[model samples]
Target: MDFFTAQDNARRKTGRLVVLLVLAVLALIVVTTLAIAVAFYLMGDQSTAQADLSAQGMLSALSIELVFGVAIGVLAVVVLGGLFKRSQLGRGGRAVAEALGGREINLNTRDADERRILNVVEEMAIASGTPVPSVYVLEEESINAFAAGYQTNDAVIGITRGTIRNLNRDELQGVVAHEFSHILHGDMRLNMRLISILHGILIIGFLGGMLLRSMRFRRVGGGGKRDNSGAIILALGAALMVIGYAGTFFGNLIKSAVSRQREYLADASAVQFTRNPEGIGNALVKIGSHTLGSHLQATQAAEFSHLFFGQGVRQGFSQIMATHPPVKERIKRVMPDWDGRFEATWPKQPDETDAPDSLDSDERSAAGHRFGSGAEPGTQAAVLTAASAQTAIGSMGQPDQRHLAQARATLGALPEQIRTAAHEPYAARALMHALLLSEDKATRKHQLEVLQQAAQPDVYQALMDYGPDVLKLDVALRLPLIELALPALRSLSMPQAQHFRICMERLIEADGQVSLFEWTLYQLLLNNLSEQGSGPSSLKLNDLQRECQMLLTVLAAAGQDDPDEISAALNAAESELPFSLTAIEDISDMRALSLAVERLRRLKPLHKPALLLAMARCIEHSGRILPAEAELFRAMSDILDCPMPPLLSEEA
Candidate 1:
C-alpha cells in the first residue's frame, strides 16, 4: 500500500478504536450503575435506617458511595488506557528478532545465500520506493519469517535458517514481498496496538490468577480466610476477572479477524509484487510438506504470530485467536486446484534418502553456484524481461515478473566491493569525506583514493557525485542510493560502524547548522544503524562522544569573535550533543557551545561563518588531523563549497 492508503487505513482504525473505547466506557458505566443499585438493594436494613435518618446525613452517605463507585470505574478505564499505551508488544516483537541472534547480512559478503537475500530485499525496496528495512536471519530450523516495528523507520525483517535452506530465490522473494506488504499497509502498527489494548483488557485476569495462587498458598498454610464477606469478595473478584478475560477473548477474536484479512491482502500483494503466484503458492506448499511446516518452537512465538509470514505458534487458543489465516485456505486462494492434502510428490529435504534425484541434484548444484549465475541464460533473460514488464495483475497493483527481475538485476549490478565496504566502519566515513571535498582534480583524486583504500569504489564515486546529481535532478534518486547502500553498511564492526555515524553527524553540522534534508538523513542513518546493532555492545556511545567533540569545534569556530558568546555556545553545544559529552575528556568546557551559537545567531546571524570557522579550529586542536577527523574538516569545507573561495597569495 502507498502512504495515502496506509494513512487512511490508520485513520479508519483509529476511528474504530475510538468507537470501541467509547462503547467500553459506556459498558463500564452501565455495569457500575447496576452494581451500585444491587449493593443498595442488599443493604435492606441500612436502607431503612438511612431513610429514617436526617435528610442531609442520608444524602451525604449516598453521595460518598456514588462518588466512590464512579471514581473506581473511571479509574479503571484510565488505567486500562495507560496500560494499552505502554504495552510492549511492539518491543516484544523486536526482542524476538534479537533473541534469534539475527545479524545484518552483508550484501557483498562472500556467502551467496546471504547476498541473494540482501539483493532481493533491496530490489523490492527500490521498486516500492521505500527505505530498505534491516534484514536478520534467525538460526532456528523453523521455516518462518516475521516483520516487526512500530513504524517503517524502525521495522525489521527476520527469516529463519530453515527458510534459507528450503526456499529458492523466487520463493524467498515471494515471502519477503509478503512481509513488505504488511509493512507498507501499516498492519504491523495496528497489530502492535491491538496487542497493547488486549493486554489492558486482560490485566484484571492476570491479577486474578496471581490472587488465586496466593489464596491457595494461604489455605495450605492454614491461614486462609473463610468468613462470608471474604468469600463474597473473592467470588466477586473471580467473576470480574472472568468477565475481564472474556473481554480479552473477544478482543483477540477481533484481532484474528483483522489479521486474517491482512494475511490475504499480503498474499495478494506478494503475488502482485513478484507477478508469480506459483512462487508464493509453491512456498506455501513446501511449508505444508516440510518437517517444520511453518511452526516455530520458540517460547515467544505466539507473541509474534501475527507478524509472521505464516503461522509460527500452535495452540488451541491460537485457533480461536489466530492472527493468520489457515494455511490451506491461503494456499487455495493462490492455487485453486490445490487439494487439502500435502503434496507428497513435491521436492524432498536436501539430504533425504527418498529425495528425487533430479530435484536434489538441481538444488544442490544451484546452491553451490553464485547468485544470478547458476540460472539458465534464457531463464535470466525471461526473468529480466518479465521484471521489466509492469503488468498490474494483483489487487495491490503488483508489478509483473519482468519488473521484479529487472529489480533483481539492478541489485546484482551493485559492486561487491562497495557493498562490502558499506558495512565497514570506514565506508560511511569515506563517503562523507568524498562528498565534502573541493571539486579540484587533486582533491577529487585524493577523495577517490581514500574511498578506494576504504574498499568502496562504487559507493565512493556515487557519493562524490550525489550532491551534484541531486541538485540537477530531484530527490527521487536519493532513496535508491541510500536503500542500496544501507544494508551493506549494517554489516560493519561496531567501532568501525560508529565512525561512519560520527561522520554523518559532522556532515550534518558541516555548515554550523543542519538542513531539513540533512537532519532527516542523519536520523534515518542513525536509526538504521541502531537497529543493526541491537546488543548492549552495539549500543555503546563511545564514538558518539568523539563526534560531539568534532561538532563542538565547529560550533566554537562559528562563534569565535566574542569570547563569552563562544564559551556559551561551546557549553550549550556540548550538552546538546547526541551522546554523553560529560564523560569525555576535554569536552567539559564545550557544554555551552549550542547556547553560544544560538545567541550568536540571534545577535549576529551573518557571523555564522566565523563561528563555524572557530568550531573547526577547536576540532583541529590536535595539530595533525586524524583520518577520521580530517573527514570532518572536509565535510565543513564541502558545505561551504558554493561561491568558490579564491586561492590566497603567499604575501597576503
Candidate 2:
C-alpha cells in the first residue's frame, strides 16, 4: 500500500466521521427538545387529558428560547463527554490496553507461547524498521487482537489469550502483520477518535438511564401535586432513555461504516506482507471454527469493537452495524476456492525443547551466511542500482517476506547474551549505553566515566559486564539491536528515561566530537523515547527549501568525507529536487542538522517520496552505502515517519 495515500485517506474519513457526529447530535437535540416540551405541556395544562402531543403542538408549547436552551444543554453534554474520553485516552494505546485489563507482556517472558508471539512482533517491527511496540495480552479467551496508538511511536499490540494458544507461528505472524498495517496506515488515531466520539453519543443514553434510576429514590409523598411532578419526571426520564438509545443505534451505524472497509484492507495487507495467503486466510477460518468466534468477553468490548482483527463484540440488531464483515466472507476473499469449511483442530504442535533464546552453531552459521560473516558490517553496498533504490523507498510501511527473513537472520546473528539483554529494561538501557562506547581506549574510558557518574549502579555494572560483546557487534546489526531494545527502554520510568537520555548525550559528547553513527544513534533513541505527532502535509518542497538544503548537506557530508565529493553528492541530490542546494560549512553542527530534519519532516506526503529519492541519490553518490551513512539515512527516514528497511549488500 502507498503509506502516505492511506494516511491521507484516513484523514478524510475522520472529517466525514465528524460530519456524521454533528448530524447525529442535531437529531438528538431536536428529539430531546420535543420530549421535554411534551412533558412540560402535559404537566402545566391540567386539561392534559386532551393535550396534543403532535410536533406542531409541542413546537407551540415550547418557546424558541426554551428550545434553544435544551439544544445547548444536549450539545454541551455530548461535547463534554467526548472531550472527557479523549482526554482519558491522551496517553494513547497503553491506556486503552489497561482499560481492557491487558497486562503488558514481559519481553523476557519464559513462557513459550508468550515468547513465540513476542518473536513474531519483534520480527515484524524490525522488518518494517519501526521500533518494537509494547505488547499486551488480554485475559480474554476469544481469538482477537488489535493494534492501538496515536502514532507508531506510542503504538501497542494486544492479543487475547485464545489467540496465542490457538494459532501457530505463521497464523500469529499474519495476525500481527494485519495490526501493523493499521499502525502504518494511521488508522489507530482514527479508531481512537471514533471511540471517544462514540462515547459522547452513548453518554446521553447513560444520562437518561441515570435519570430513570434516580426517580425511584425521589420522594413523591406531598399529595396529588407531588404525584403529577413524579409523573412528569417519569415521562422525561423514559423519553431521554429512548432518545439516548436511538443515538447509540446511529453511532453504531457510523462506526460500522467507517470501520468495515478498513478491516478488509487490513486483511489484504496481511496477505501482502507475509506473501502467504493461507496464513491470514486460515487464521480467519480458525476464528470461524472456534466457539467464541473472535468475540471479546470484556465489558467494554463494544467500545473498542472497531479496533479488533475480528468483530470483538456481538453483532448489532442489524448486520449494517457490524464493524467487521462476516467471517466466511472474509475467508473467501483470502482463499477464493475454499469449500467453506472451518476445521476446529489443526496438526498438533511439537513439544519445545530448546529455548528460543538459544541459537545452535548451525543456526548461527546460516545467519552469518545470509549477512556475510567475513565482510565488515556496514561497508556492504546498499541500493546498488537506481531501480533498487526506488524499490527500497517504495517498500516503506509495507515489508515483504524477504525483509522478514532478513530480520530473523539479523536476530540470529546477535550474541545470545546481547539478545537477552535487549529484552530487560535495565539491561536494555545498558546495551544502549554500551553501543555509544568509543573504540579508542582513552575515549572509551572517558565515556565509561561519564556513564558511571550519571547512571544507576546496577545499570553501570550491566554495561561494564556486556560492554565487550556490544562493542564487538557487527555495524549493520547495531541499529536493529537498538530497535529491539526500544520497547524495553520505553518501559523505563519517566525519571529513568530522562536520566538515560542525559547519559547518552554526555557519552556522545565525551569523545569531544560526534561521529556520524553516534549522531544517528542518539537521534534514533531520543526520538523513540518521546511521542511524535504528525501535522498537515501542506508544505511543498519549495516551502522548506532551506530546511531541505541543510538536511541534504548533512547527509552528503556523512556519505563523503572529501569537501569536493560532498559538493558532488549535493549536486546529485539537487538533480532530484526542484531547486539548487548549498552545503553548510560547519557539517559537524549537529544541532543545526537536527533542526533542519524537524522542519523537513513536515513536508507534504506526496512530496516526501521525492525528497526520499533525493536523499538516496545523495548517498548513492559514493557508489555505496557505508555503515555510518546507512545508519544516518535510516535514522533520518524514521524521524520523517518513513520506515526504511534494513540496507544490505546486493548479493544478500
Top TM-score prediction, candidate number? 2
Q: What C-alpha lDDT do the candidate models reach, one value each?
A: 0.52, 0.83
Scored by lDDT, model 2 comes in at 0.83
In model 2, where is the ten-residue run with the lowest total lDDT?
346-355
How well does each candidate superpose onto the true structure, as a TM-score? Answer: 0.59, 0.95
User: Where in model 1 is the C-alpha error above 4 Å?
Assistant: 1-3, 21-93, 99-116, 220-237, 315-320, 344-402, 432-438, 442-479, 487-502, 505-652
- Per-residue CA lDDT of candidate 1, range 1-652, in tens? 5333553565477558656655654554444444444334333354464456554443433455675676576558546754754554335345547754666554446555565666667767655545567778877776788787765545678888778667777788889889877766668767766656655555544655666555553333243433234343454455555555655555556567568888898898888878888778888888887876888877656545666888887746457677777788888998898767775433234453222211144443442232234333212211111111112111122443544543444344333344344454445445434434433566445544554455345545556544343222212223344555555565566776765666555444444544334543454455445643221111122333454454464434442446554455455444433343332323233334333322332311122233334334443333322222322332232222100111111111
Error of 2 at 467 (Å): 1.3
Tell me the alpha-carbon RMSD of every candidate: 15.5, 2.5
**Model 2 lDDT per residue over 555-621, tens place:** 8877657889999999999988999998877768788777877777777677888899899988887
lDDT of model number 1: 0.52
Runs in model 2 lying further than 4 Å from the true structure:
219-222, 345-361, 374-387, 532-536
